[model samples]
Target chain A: MHIPDGFINVPTVVVTSAVSAGAIAYGVSRANRRLGEKHVPLMGVMAAFIFAAQMLNFPVAGGTSGHVLGAALAAILLGPWVGVLIMACVFIVQCLIFQDGGLTALGANILNMGIIACFVGYYLYQGVVSFWGERRRSQLVAAFLGAWLSIVAAAAATAIELAVSGTSPLAVALPAMAGVHVLIGIGEGLVTAAVISLVMTTRADLLQLERV
Target chain B: MRYSFLDQFSDLDSFIHRLDPRTKLVSCLAFILAIVLTPPGRWQVFLGYFSLLLILIIISKVPVFYVLKRSLVILPFVVLVSLFIPFFKEGEVAGSYNLWLWQVSVTYTGLAILGNVVTKAWLCVLGLILLSATTGITDLLKGLEGLGIPRVIVLILSFMYRYIFVVVDEAMWMRQAWHSRSFGNKGLRQIKTLGNIIGSLFVRSYERGERVYVAMLARGFDGKVRTLHSLTFRKADFYCGGLWFILLVVTGVFLW
Candidate 1:
């Protein structure tokens, strides 16, 4: 869901950039107050981990594979605010270093993959876990659903941005982007659930870390 | 192990590479904005932007083929998203075809938009390639910090660049180990194994982060990051940056 330049117009870029910048600023301040000196190396390493994890692809079907977006997993492990910062860092590095995303479209890409994905996944996972009383099975199921919905939501947001930009009509971009992501989201969900389960078994204390 | 792949051509000496990274960074953004903000269907403007990037690439001493190959990274995505625009757009139909139970038609407007999008995206990508290829990653991060991006963000970026390869190597070794141990099992079991790999990676990275923090503290580290060298803007930066800005304005105004 990395929207390259020209896929959206100038106004869309301006609006999304403003929104993402505000969210990131708020996240940064919150993290500064809450985390102090420890957050720097930790967040940086987390961002690197997410970036490296994205490169590790798992086979999805016949001759096709998908990789984890890592937003939900990040949020599930860390808090939403730190998740935002980590994802934004990953997106920035990807855009500047690798050109995996366009410079002009950086705002929209961060808005979709960083902010939207993290918040949606985090809130959904929290809601599910809270409602289900945080049993191991419930937490795993919540993680799966949260990861799945996060991808779909991010894809939907991209489609909406494209439609508003006059690049494609909503009727077409909406279903197409969301439909493809639904399958990809399944892979994301499975990986997230398994990873959480692994964490739960090994370092359960990590899961109990205070969400910033 | 090949860590320099991210900015492979940045070490080469040239006018483009020698200019302040801030200069190259601003110029690249200006070029991309010009390409993206141009009105659709303006082939002349698009061609002008393409040639501008080509000249820069030539000056930077980066291989044209390398830039072209890197630019193609966006092609599959562009094609995937815009492939249906030609069918869904409402305009004077250029051609009509019958496929099973449905009649599909391609419109000239749709084709034109598709071409414009692909062209614009290509130009912007080439501009980015020019910036990244000419500027080393460390220099680029320093440039970003010089440009008044937040200090913590810059620090995070530097750390990410420093350790991304380390984590990547670890992940690759784990993948090799997995392949060696497991049969070609497919389905939930495979996903579970992959998850274990990722989970283990996260744990290792997190612990390494703690170790690094402790190491930094041992060296009398504060929250502030200090670098040995600082960037200085030269006369060439002003001349080149001014020239690039003027060219962008002239092209945007005259062509529009």
Candidate 2:
């Protein structure tokens, strides 16, 4: 979730911003190595795709709709570094251009949505796929688990940040944030799994090339 | 199809719109920092911050109703996130509730904090809306670059701004195709169709990326992106920054 400004205190903001800056710097260098002159523009396109995909709402059960968060999807489709970079880019644009997120809390948003979601979701997907043997079914299962867990994890991290900021005690914030997100995670899992399955069926080669 | 851009009013001529984007960008950040850093329950300070943003909204001539409406998007989320704070935060119990196995008590201090958080977030969003509504995304990115953000990130954002609508249109076409083909699909079938749309969208995007790269290469593209430095700080920018600084200092003094 996008943490608006004032939700977390000033010290939390400073610390998270520093961490986000480091992670983004590392992500950019890593992406540079992965992407050559011929592939430089691909990152921007992928970021755009993620942003557009996020705007598309699909029907979940009970007539409710949810859109793609695209972190797990990005990491699985691209490498983790590229995934993180794309996510960071998207968040920055959302904050500065769209005002969808707060400028002061941009670091917290990136940390939660970009770094944590991409890395944890990517590694978890890889672990599940490897352990279960990569197949169409395994791809679906891994995508589902990765997306689901990543969202819950980000929510948990946000709760901790809030607690640390003394906005709310961890005991209260953790369960509340986690409970809502656990349901949100299911939506995330379904969308991520469906897309990954379709991609696996069509452009299996792309996934193979990007697989870490 | 025509899509309305996010910064539709950015091209409008106004004092706020004409100011250097870098100045606006930094000032906006400063405004937000000032809002967030204010101690909770500082009602006067919050009001001061709100008035400052309201003045900017008026000067920007971006239509106060539009900014207010857009800023309301954050309210649901803020309420959802902080709704339980009063109940869970342990302090002087303002009220107590008994619901089966749980006893929930809300504290006045917690309620005050929650109110403070919501007000601060709303004000911060208003400030940001003022910034973005006045400055184009391209100029915003340029301002960020001039402020020392890395080049790679800026390039990525510039392209994202340019092509986000393109991808959206592509996704919209796919949705139209799906809606037109499947009359009454629901449940798993609907998700599957949506998945197909997203999957195909990704492939299309990937191919487009390749095509764009090749097109760039055809023009003797290099890794480094260069842009014209057309942004110049005016006396107004300095005055604007100074005015904000003075207002913020006054608020800080009031806090003290």
Candidate 3:
């Protein structure tokens, strides 16, 4: 879902870059103010973990495999702001070092994957957990739905950007992007739920760590 | 154990390799931005950009095969996203096909746009490959830091770089263990097992982070990260960067 450079127009790039930059700057200041010294290493390590975890692909269907985008998982594990930071870092590294995404499209990628995914997944999870009571089952259910929707939401956002850039029309891009991601989102949901359950069983304290 | 995959050719000596990372980073961004902002169907401008990248690839001395292979990674995605454009776009019909109960037509404008998108994406990818293949990851991060990227981000990137391989190795081991224990299990069962592995990895990484933080505190690490070698832009940076920028501007003006 990483958008390449030419797929987006200049206005879209500039606007998205401005928004992402502002959000990241806010996140950095929040990290500094709220968590102080500990969050630096913690966020760093979590970013690395997310990056590496993405490499661990699981079999989906038809002999194909998919990996966790880790935005929802990160947001569930860390708070949304820190999740945003972690994901932005991951996107930047992927773009610069791995060339997995485009340089000019970095802002759009970050806005979709970093901010929108994390925020949507996180708030949805929080809302579900709060509404359903934070039992293990509810948390797992929340994780699943939150993760599933996050991917779809990011995909939709990507499609909208593509349409707005005139790369693809909304009539085509919307349904196509969202339709494919719906399945991918299921895999993301399952992995997210399983991972949450595992963490709940093994190291629940990590989940309880102070959120910044 | 082999972590060279990240920056395999960065150690090679060449003018591109030796140029300040900041210069390379800025040049790369400029190159891609120029490529992306250029109006579509400017075949000459696109060719000029490609030639510029080709010249850099040659100068960098990284294997041509490696650069080509790396740049091709974007093709499947580009194709997947834009493949239907030719059919969906409204213009002069290039061809029409009757499939089952429906008729589909491809448009000349749509095909042209699709081709233009692919070309732009490919040129941008080539520019990125040149930047990444020549500069060490460390130097790139340092350059980003030098360019006024936040200290927090730079630190996070550095720590991530240091430990990604370690985490990846652990993940591989866990996958190996799972493969040994499971016997052709597919579906939810497989996803559950993978989830457990991810959770365990997360826990281990979190603890490692704590340990690292404690170690840093013990070694007098404040909230600030300090590096000994700072990046400096020498005479070569200005000359090369200026020439490249001028070339890009000239191409944009004359070609446009």
Number of the top-ranking candidate, with lDDT as the measure: 3
Give me the overall lDDT of model 2. Answer: 0.83
Clashing pairs in 3: none
Tens digits of lDDT, candidate 1, A37-92: 88889898999999989988877778977889999899889999999999999989
State the lDDT of candidate 2 residue by residue for B104-192, as single tens digits. 78898788777888888888888888888898878888899899998877887877777888898998888888888888787677777
**Interface RMS deviation of candidate 3:** 1.0
Measured against the true two-chain complex, the DockQ scores of the candidates, in the order shown, are 0.79, 0.72, 0.80
Question: What lDDT does candidate 1 reach at residue A70?
Answer: 98
Lowest summed lDDT across 10 adjacent residues in model 2 chain A is found at A31-40
* B138-248: candidate 1 lDDT, tens digit per residue: 999989988888988988888888889899999999988988887887899999999999999999999999899999999998888877877989998999999989988
Sort the candidates on lDDT, descending order. Answer: 3, 1, 2
Instruction: Kindly list the per-residue Cα lDDT of model 2 for residues A96-156, writing each as its tens digit.
Output: 7677777778888989988899888999999998999977898799999999988998889
Query: For candidate 1, what's the TM-score of chain A, rounded to 2 decimals?
Result: 0.98
Better of 2 and 3 by lDDT: 3
What's the C-alpha lDDT at position A34 in model 3?
Answer: 91
Between which residue pairs do clashes occur in model 1? none
For residues B1-256, what per-residue lDDT tens digits would candidate 3 score against the true structure? 6878888798899999999999999999899889888888899999887887888899889998998888887876787676567556578999988988868788888788888888888888888888888899999998998999988889988888988888888988998899999989888999999999999999999999899999999999888766797788999899999999999999888877
Candidate 3 per-residue lDDT over residues A90-120, each given as its tens digit? 9998999888889889999999999999999
Cα RMSD (Å) between model 2 and the true structure? 1.7
lDDT of model 3, residue B19: 95
Q: Interface RMSDs of all predictions?
A: 0.9, 1.3, 1.0
